[model samples]
Target: MNWCTRCVLPDTRPGIVLDAAGVCSACRAHGTRDEAVDWAARAAAFGELVERTRALDRRWDCVIPVSGGKDSTWQVVTCLEHGLHPLAVTWRTPGRTPLGQQNLDNLISLGVDHVDFTCSPLVERRFLLASLDRFGTTAIPMHLALFNVPLTVAARYDVPLVVWGENSAAEYVGDTAATHRLDAEWVRRYGAVHGTTAADWVSDELTERDLAPYFGPTDAELEAKGIEAVFLGEYLRWDPEMTARVAAEHGFRARDEGPRTGVYAHADIDDDFISIHHHLKWPKFGFTRSFDNLSLEIRNGRLTRDEAIARLRELGDETPYDDIAKFSAYVGIGTDDFFARAERWRNPDVWTRRDDGVWTIEGFLVDDWPWS
Candidate 1:
């Protein structure tokens, strides 16, 4: 709720720190760019990685599972530029937003042969509803869609190396442990909890069991096959600004025309679900979806914490109409249940209860709800 005096980040951001002068570390780092980043060296290392990794057997030098976001585009282009025969994989999740589908289509048009993995919509819907009801969220398959599906495909097809768009800790947040450099542990403990983020708000339908499908090789499996999922950001210094500029030359657009931080910069792509969730988290955790991005913006002095928070507050809960209707129908519940759960998780102060014993928005439930 409170903006940091020195940086463009608000106190709502988790694990934020302020110096005596009220400045943030991102601001401090800005002063040391010459020492912090060596773009030439980074680019060279990236080239080296492509040359070296591609020299490996060529069964599939590497695979980049892409959603065709700015970052993914960069990753794919870089893989080719580096001389790697990279196979692209895309998962056709049920009810993919139009913008998301467009992004995917654009990615495929780049002449990269891609394999789309789409599962049973009924099964996906059942799990999506279960997770949404239990966790007050509909974006439950995020973990599986992002990590598991591509990984499973890689494993089954004998692809040894899988490349990800970016690494969170080094690019976005400060996880100053020595492991910040690309290494084995980066893959092992990539997350804080079981995976993804916290358990506070997830879809209930997607159980831990659902994740078992994507867990990439047992130690035995990885060892026997030498399977490695690498974060391209590591080893190569990640320059989001440069990545965006180049991606634009190759035709990248922001999904929402909003500020594309982190992996986005091209001014058009899908911003509703990811953007809305980040905006919602503002009042609760005080950070947007892309924390490192906010930090980067702060370091560069493009944004102020007050401005970020205010902008975040201005965002609305914009769910696509078809997605809302289909998800509601799939859950076998009306849209009321979906809205009620979402309102409860987002801003508890807005859920209104019926004075006449019906659930309505007559009043926000913050003061009335037991959870508050």
Candidate 2:
């Protein structure tokens, strides 16, 4: 539960490394981007990639997996602004909020041809509940489909390129070696599913064929089709607030108020269950969305470390019980069962209960930075 010297991230976060100086790997990674990366050169390389993909005999130059959130909208606009035709693809989350649906439709209003893929609700519910029951997070299936389905569509449409958003390794987690890779193996290991494959989720009721959409193509198939997937964030600087502003100009809307659990008004707005998913991180990882959002702001130089720490203290662990109740109803589980399952998933290495019955993490509440 040691905190990063430079950001609000805890050492308990997976793939995070705190150096002897106490700076976390994510802060170190951002330092590399700021100090060494030549954005002009990267942009040039991206232009070449766009040209090569556009020359392929396909209806679209690339497939951009979108959530109709600010980042996806920004990705679509970025492709269009660079003269690349992108086919936007969305794997619809089961708990689609009204605003989520409207924002998703906004992508179409931007004049791009869009495809929405939905799973059978019965199967999706079963998978979601199973994920909650086993992994303590309901986002496993959604994460799997988010990364897999777009590539499947790319192969089906004969599109040679798939454009993804940020590289989590570069922005959030992983060692320096992973900062620049977007290969299937890298994604399979560190992407949202966090090494949990669809094979791990197969059950008596769910067959291989039923889970095909969640399974990405084999490496040979992807290579044979000449599919090249790249991260747009690597080429262009990624600032969530900036992207939200840009997307707002293009008909995207943010939540009227900030979400119950996080600082961002626009992020994760497409799914009502996202807040619950983020809230669960507190018990499991000792930190949650506030740490993530504030870290980004810290990296972007928008907030001082003190301000970020204050914000995290004020808002980080506030659980959105309403969102949790919604998710429980969606998965046909009781609210008590939901909390019981959440408690089961808490990492004892990171969390302890006080006499007052409040959960807390050790070595995380810093009175000041630059700890000696």
Candidate 3:
């Protein structure tokens, strides 16, 4: 229930630690990035990498994993601006919106080879439901595919570099000094699949072959093949608003409906089901996507802690009802069953049921939270 003095994020968020000053690790990491990071030096290093990859004279100098999000578009624009020919790759979410597809097409029209890697819909459905039933989240399959697809493409195509957008560990988990390589170890730590790999998810229903797209080349294989998967965030500064602006300048469109899951119209908008993954955090960690987005804004000096709190109060009852219905239908489950399974994973430490049969977080940041 401990909230960061600098931002609205709580200590309950996994991998977030509050130091003695009551500042969360993520905010402290952002401070370190601002004060200690030598962005000019990092940019020079990236320039060298770009030159080296270009000199390889391959068909594609890099593989950029993308979801048509602002960050991914920014990644593509940055790579193209650096004169690196990157093959854009998408994992093809089952819940992709029309806007998502349009943005993806626009990114491809930015002039690069693209691959829309689609796993079997049957397998995806089974995996989605299994992930929901077992891990209490529907994002495991999506995360697995997004992480694995581009790397697999890179290894198979002999692309020397895989350009990932950002290091979630550094930005979200306070691991500011994380290795630039997005290898198996990094996946195990920050892949958001509960530290489980594709092999671990094999079940009676989902065979190894059915989950082939989820398995990427191992670190050893990547090393042997001289395939280096790196985070572009390590080389260049990454701010959410800045990235969104860059994307908007490059023909990326924001949602007309606004703020699908968080404070940004541009984020987490690629997949309809992804919001459910973030919404479930309210029950499990006592925070919503608004907390995450607002924390970043506070860290970036766009909002005060009090202002972020007010925004959270305004964004009450962030229960992705339509998304839940669509996802439930896709996974052949009822809406009642969906919530019932989500309820099973509610963190007892963060939530308490009231006498009136409503769940509430006792030490929540918002004093008058509209708990539904």
- The best candidate in terms of TM-score: 3
Report the candidate with higher TM-score, 1 versus 3: 3
Task: Tell me the whole-model lDDT of each prediction, alpha carbons only.
Answer: 0.56, 0.82, 0.91
**Candidate 1 local lDDT, 123-149, one digit each (tens):** 565655555545544554545455656
Which runs in model 2 stand beyond 4 Å of their true positions? 179-181, 366-372
Candidate 2 C-alpha RMSD relative to the actual structure: 3.0
Each candidate's clash count: 15, 0, 0
lDDT of 3 at 350: 87
Residues 203-271, candidate 3: write the lDDT tens digits.
Answer: 899999999999988888999989899999999998889999999999999999898998999898889
Query: How do the residues 1-372 of candidate 2 rate in per-residue lDDT, one tens digit apiece?
Result: 688888888888888899999999989888786667788998999999888887775889889999999999999989998888889999988888888889889887887888899988888888888888788887788888998899899888888888898787777773646745367777776876868778877879778777887888766888899998888988888878888998999999998977645788888888888888888887898778878888889988999899988876565347788888888898888999999988899899987777877666656754432211
What is the overall TM-score of model 2 with all chains considered together? Answer: 0.94
After TM-score superposition, the amount by which residue 48's alpha carbon in candidate 2 deviates from its true location, in angstroms, is: 0.6
RMSD of each: 6.5, 3.0, 0.9
lDDT of 3: 0.91
